[model samples]
Target: MAKVSINLATGSIQKEEIIVGIDLGTTNSLVAFINPDKNPQVINDTGKGVLVPSVVHFGPAGEITVGNEAREYLVTDPQNTVFSVKRLLGRSYHDIENYKDFFSYKVIDDDSESLVKIKVGDKFYTPIELSSLILKELKARAEHALKTPVNRAVITVPAYFNDSQRQATRDAGKLAGLDVLRIVNEPTAASLAYGIGLNPEETKTIAVYDLGGGTFDVSILQIQNGIFEVLATNGNTFLGGDDFDSAIVDYWIEKNQLNKADIIADNKLAQKLRLKAEEAKRAFAYQSLVNDKIGDIWCTLDRNTFEQLILGKVQETITCCQNALKDAKIEVGQIDEVIMVGGSTRTALVKKMVAEFFGRPVHDEVNPDEVVALGAAIQADVLAGNRSDILLLDVTPLSLGIETMGGLMDVIIPRNSKVPTKAGRQYTTSIDGQVNMKIAVYQGERDLIKENRKLAEFDLKGIPSMPAGFPKVDINFLLNADGILKIQAIELRSGVKQEVEVKPTYGITDDQVEQMLLDSITHAKDDVSQRMLIEARVEGEQMVKQVEGFLRKNSDFVSIAEIADTTKYIDKLNAALTSGDKDAIHKAIDELNEFTRPFAERLMDQAISHAMKGKSIE
Candidate 1:
């Protein structure tokens, strides 16, 4: 049996669950909580610094290491070490096709819109799984420091993160054995940490300039009546302090006349140079010049040259700030305050440029690396009914979503979202000539639809038949004041529309909701595994059908031998699917794709030739 108490004034939960705030970063991550004195502080367990290196290493015998312990593997065994995984979260292979070389590890690319996966040795892992490992580390750290069970958390993400990315973060937290209370925006959390919007009567418009290790983002925000609204956000996901380090590396490489290819081939030399570059970057902050050496190679840098090297990258952030302000429909003078966040903000150049752009002194009173986490702690405390001075609106207890491909629940309205809200996402068909899409709505916290409760379902018919991934469909969920959910589906290309209304709480009881939440947390691993298997099966089936269609329609252009091989590969894939082994199915899918790619290309060439027949070159 459990107890539940609600605060009538704030509409929050008054319980003993100690929810911590987590700032999961690209280069580092940390967890924080509100101290007994009602002040937020970062957990420094056993004097082991606050920052946890966002790196993981896998041993040969199924052993794993995270944080600082795993960082050494980045140089010793780049193939087994994973870093900067935050950039890959919720992104498809096509989204990062141009930047795949950035990672030293193998990122599997099947030339599809599916979520990206990483391969270390023989096993494959998703970004969500890697991120969960980091979260698990943080959870352990928090529990060790606070001497209490920390099973709930509020995680921060970039303001520009879309629904998919936010959902991915939530899923990672769930996988880490934590109930993700909320997904707070990084800029918003920074504002709270600086006490910029604590006073209910305070009204201000501010800019949060965050430049982390591997990402940069600037957001314009408006705070009124204790409500923070993001006006605009813009930044380059691939631009940040990492770029600065690379710039230094490139400068040294050119100056030393070192072969870039040779440096990449030699791991020790590459790591040595990278470390030296980092040291120079930090030294230039207070010293006029920095001099170092790696064996016989001299690494020398002065502040002037160092600044010049990263000047272009800094200018890019400035441009993004300008664009963010423009999108917010405000001028630099209109901004009340500027907040600096992320370790990169410690650079004098970054501060000076940001100050000059906003015509104000940037706020750096709090530690940039820990600000977001601290703010998250404050939000968690508020949610725990520790404060009544600030009031929060009602929120949904569980996530509401629709059944997507492979019986996966695609959450449209996440748990704890403020009621009377509307959110939507655009989706495309996975099969060609598909005219109807079945919309199965579900309500619960699990990742798989089988574990959730069905509310209602309907079909959006009469879609224009086209190639796969052609027809764009937008799904929207609107929850009203009375908790009535209205789901709408619209096909943008054909102008077709369908909608349905369902009472989510019609037959559901409070005890049932509580059970669902507990089950979601208790069986999180099983739920995620099942979801992944189903997704793999769905993708394999789609690939099998597409390959068969290609062979049938273009038999005249493709070689008979190629057709035979592709057919055999498809049969193997179908067999694997029936066996319910996700890895085996994926392997077969990869083989079939590799064999048919050339055949498809040849067919494409023939079609082009036929279309251009008798046409003038001019």
Candidate 2:
């Protein structure tokens, strides 16, 4: 890392210092720099001397490629090639189905809860490991290009990535030997990419519509006098251009009458089809129609047809924007400007949709794709004291709550609440002689226990076995600046302190991160990948079984699927239960259940029916 001197009094630019901002994206990863003169540039890591493609490939002969070189392998070596790996980064095997159509290799349930292990050429690597490879390659590119070690950087993640995922991202940065200064939200960073360049004291409200290769986010930000406050943000970490590309592929498949086989059945065909779809999508962004012939089928797709094919998916992306506005409690009309970010936002249809939603045209001053990386660098400047005019106030996207009586979720801190916030819950023993108190932590808005995510569990051990009604414990849940949770429990009577367990769920644990780093270097290639995949698959099955059972038991009220379609996926899952391939199991599990949907309205309807059916004594 290079150090540069700056004049604090006047906020004037000074000498040159090298600080890189890294956008470790799902479908692509890039490193950027802000020179001493405030001239920003994105470093090229390609074979042709450009940005890396964030794709990785493995072969039987210990051969590998990165950047553009590895990207071409999608067309050349389908079975062993991997792309959009960022989708798997910090996500469980259960989350892989959103992009499973594009992954050439298979995913297995690794033993880790937060890890997805890919099996390829008799080997396996967690998405984190693959991410590190890309990050390391980017680091190397930065150092090699600058002829200096690139140790310090800022990384970006989807606005919706939870604390665990964000931590995993930071862990990947450390694995790559980079000092990840901060993990900024992709949309927030893009705001800074432009805000920092403008004169201070100007108040601007921007609604960021970010549709990336593998994730979608909508962020509402308020910038005043250079202070960037993220009012509200929401997104689907699993939704992105990848789905649109798959839609195109599905279009080709359906048009060509190739429904005879599963898309995953032929590695080569899946890879080629994805490539063709991506090309057509890119072309259709400008031209009315894209004449693309690259896979098992040939087709000419007009922009109108392409837009219609992805209308639902696109609506889902816009829904995120709508959700963000609702979370912010701000109306769309109040937004000063609408900014678009990410590679997939280039589509004219996307622009049209956004314009219609906001009832205004989007600001296209900054390139949607590179704005995030640029904003990351700007934040890096702020953290390093290069710029003092800016201050950012961010909020946690999910509510923090604890399980209550009857497995109901009692929320402590609501979503979009400012960080470094504190809340406490006073819990008393329920029975006559309750020895231990179980406080299960959860995230999400659902009042039902099973519907929410179990983050961790705290046990108040070594009680005097006193009467349950007499014993009391106060559990304090505090969220720090980094959005990491810390919990503490104090016994009111005895004054004895119970252990505070800040254990994380749904993402890689700290121990796993440390172990992964060592294993990446020492483990035999094929074995590690195999182990990770198996673990991922099993967990995926677990998720499937739980959600599927819930769906079947309450079939009448589900907004999820038509009865026939729902049963079909369930049958497919049943068929895959015996399959040894963890990836397939995981993929099947995820495809069946996704989104924060309110399932089986009949549950509520049943409650009301029961109440109504009981005749009033009056």
Candidate 3:
């Protein structure tokens, strides 16, 4: 029998889980949830405030700090602190080469089109890893405030974010141990927070003008029957409130007649001036003029001067708004509402300009910084089936996945995902010189592929031959409103692609699906155990192959005793694989990895030293 929990006071069945809403912004991030009073509220745990700075610091002893605590290290240890990491997500070094100077830390430039990585001390971190740290912090805070273990979430991203960026965000959430239910658009979330489109009869065209700390975007949305559709979006990922603070900094540098080169050279001095400039920008909200000092540096700015200095930057956003409307094929008069989001929109000139352009009063009553997150909470509520007024979304009947190594089902889209959704995950070749991959798709709720119904199978050809794990294959599943699933696989390095379509529910009765789901649940324990054993065997085989290949190619670098020890571990792993014991296989793999890691690092260090000396080792 299924178990249910009842609230003692209300004598009502309580929700089995709470799904929080997260706004993982470039400059700041926050989490929100539906409170017991049936209202969307942002969590403020221990009065640390609603906003968490998206900064990370790595200490010399390998400790890591995130959010407000990490923000303090920006000036003291600029080289080890990472900020504005969202800009690097899914981006190649070439994509941001022009804006490299904007970063205070080291961003590795390997002269390739692959994803960028940030170097902190001796360690390198991908944007996804850094982002996961921030998400983990938000998850901890939400759990503390709600007094519950929060695991699922609906994350909001900019409407302008591309597929790779969206996928990166999903991966980060997964790394942070959150099962992301939906990746909502920032503008849609903002609209929901304002109570728009809650009534089925309401129809409106709205513009969401968002200018946050490190990014800006203007989205034109059409809402009807509780459905929000984005008409057009345009903005620069690198332009936002941070640039406004920069404008003030530049003005102060010019007005004070200070040595520009010297200020730029002094990292601490530069950060202090930037902080003072931010303070002055905030003070301009109520005061006409402000004067401040950071040590020997003088910071003074009048409201008029600050406005003039940033006029061109703000006008650029207006031009983007114009372009968005043009693409949407709507005039300003057609807009029924103008919603302002982002803390930067608190600027007086920004409000005045947006209000005049839309020919409507802007909605700023809701806290601009928390609007996206609040809207996200409302969306989470809708997904939780707590709001009947909102339109119910159609969802997939069963999970869709591809058969991985070991005949295990690797789910790309989980069951009950809302329709018209697209999701993907990356895979790599397990064999050397792999030039093609066979993709077999399946649909069901089981953990093993043999128990699921096969939908279709296809081959992705023309993958460039490379060492195992060198070729990146991205498989995407696009399920439309009509229940048709279109699967596409692409080798990112070679641009080779293949696509196929299948109807997951065609000719399959509701009774069969119900039985399949019931059977999956009934045999869940046994199926999971078998699946784990198969997976462990596959992993052991892969590790054995990789280690053997490494020895064959680089045996000259290692001593005879080291080779003998490595061979012994490989033999033990092979024995475990034949034993059909998952725990034993895992233990062997762990021992092998731990034994090989030291020599691997030594080899890597030697290679780097040789490369730096303009030489290559055979």
Candidate 4:
């Protein structure tokens, strides 16, 4: 067995083994680590390139392939392939309903506020699960290249990602059998790779312009005393390199006099054109024109035309930079350095525009695609105590959470998170027409709230009565430098709100906090087990209530035999919940969901038909 050691002071695992850094991107993902020479290096196992395409494909026999191997299925089996899953992370059906057609695979539209799920064949998967597959591939690559068992990682996400998206990334890491040490911001990581924050005495303000395959963001950061603080972040998640390629495709279509709808309808032709567009985009770096052909289609584009096509998109990024600077309360002259990150930044137009906007030479010495992972590796090194000169900022002493279902502590602000931070998560009521919700705040490292210290409790009243999961309740935790915690709960639909203040450090001694941390680590396995069982039971109960409510409301739509079958599955789930077996509860829940889906979909179809009886299309 591998040796394990824990730091009593921080309650974190000691870094006796290598901890890799991962840049999980929308179009690609890669892993990096601190080499034996103490320099961060991206891992390229065998002859495979440093970048792995962020794609997953399920075979007919249920076998799954990720990365380069899976990229082939985009044209061959688009329905079975999943791409750009990062966009769906922590998102609900309502969040992505507008752009559902952008995806080739089936993204379930359950008309609920629950997290989005992707359907492949007969199996359902959340974005967290799909992302884990990509991470697993990265982990395997790292281990194969290093000739060691890698299990710890620091993953990087966009600076604009919210708390839910970050949490989803952490969960993806866990599911991939890796201990996610930290979720670092992509801009911060890129800055680290550029050696912008290594000096404690030298302070500088920098602008990081990141334009990746499917997203764009500009972040204003200040580095002082070895601390990297993000002053402001702004970006369009839907705008990126892909849009640039699409412009090329559009140009080609207009030139060839081909129908756009026909091209889209032919998946194979669309993929061919998209791939060719990407090739043409890359070719512009060395030449002024790219004249190519795919079968009968003519792919001819000049550098000037390409630039003109994407001029609007590049201008949009510059506008974001302007807004970021305004929000940071800084002028262009105040920016000491400008760093370029993401593969899209390699374009000459992007580089020129960004440099001109900053009124300074931009830093592009490091590979744009690999900078984030390299910087993350450097951060992992620092966390491993390999760098003594770098000092991390002050952080929260313990995890702060609210009591969720089954008395489980749903952490909002995790332990060791940098203070003066804000985080929030959306929750909903368990019962239909729940007008009030009790928000019980707790602080500790345990999974159960009863085992933690209760900070405060209050009720958020006056919520509008609606069906379960209809109300959007947002709970936010804001912790300041003085250790004062402010918890706010708000119902978005009804405008009902409640707020509470608690000094988390008021009564607890430092030694007591240390003891709690130690206990949490010591009982980590058991605590996880208990937490899992409780969560399963809670899910089972919710499923039962929803099924019962559905049957009561739509009795005329469902057959008697269907109701009896659903009741039978519900009874099985109830028994499983009582048995306190997590696996059994999951299995029962899955069976019921599978059985009920067909009829539920039929009911929905019928309801739509009935509602559209007198309606005419505009």
Q: Is candidate 1 or candidate 2 better by lDDT?
A: 1
Q: Would you list the clashing residue pairs of candidate 1?
A: none
Prediction 4 TM-score vs. true: 0.79
Q: Is candidate 2 or candidate 4 better by lDDT?
A: 4
Output the worst ten-in-a-row residue range by lDDT, candidate 1: 5-14
Candidate 1 lDDT for residue 57: 97
Best by lDDT: 1
Off by over 4 Å in 3: 1-14, 397-417, 420-437, 442-455, 460-618
Assess every candidate by TM-score.
0.94, 0.62, 0.73, 0.79
Cα-lDDT of candidate 4: 0.88
- Order by lDDT, highest first: 1, 4, 3, 2
Compose the digit string of candidate 2's lDDT tens values, residues 391-450.
Answer: 545766556688866555666665545677787766777555676778788875344556
Candidate 4 lDDT, tens digit per residue, 216-243?
9999999888887899999998999999
1-618: candidate 1 lDDT, tens digit per residue:
877755332345655767899999999999998865679999887787999999999999979999988998888888899999999999999999999999999998888888998888777788999999999999998887776678899999999888888999999999999999999999999999998888899999999999998889999999999888999999998888878888888888888889999987888888788878888888877798888778777788899998899999999999999999999999999999999999999889999989998898999999999999999999888788788887887898889999988788999999899888999988888777999999999999998898899999999999999998899999999999899999999999999999999988787788998899999999999988888788889989999888788777777877778777777898899999998777787778777887777776776788799999999997
Number of the top candidate by TM-score? 1
lDDT tens readout by residue for model 3, 124-216: 567887998999999999988776778788999988877668767876776677767788899999999999878789999999999998888
Stretch of 10 with least lDDT, candidate 2 = 519-528
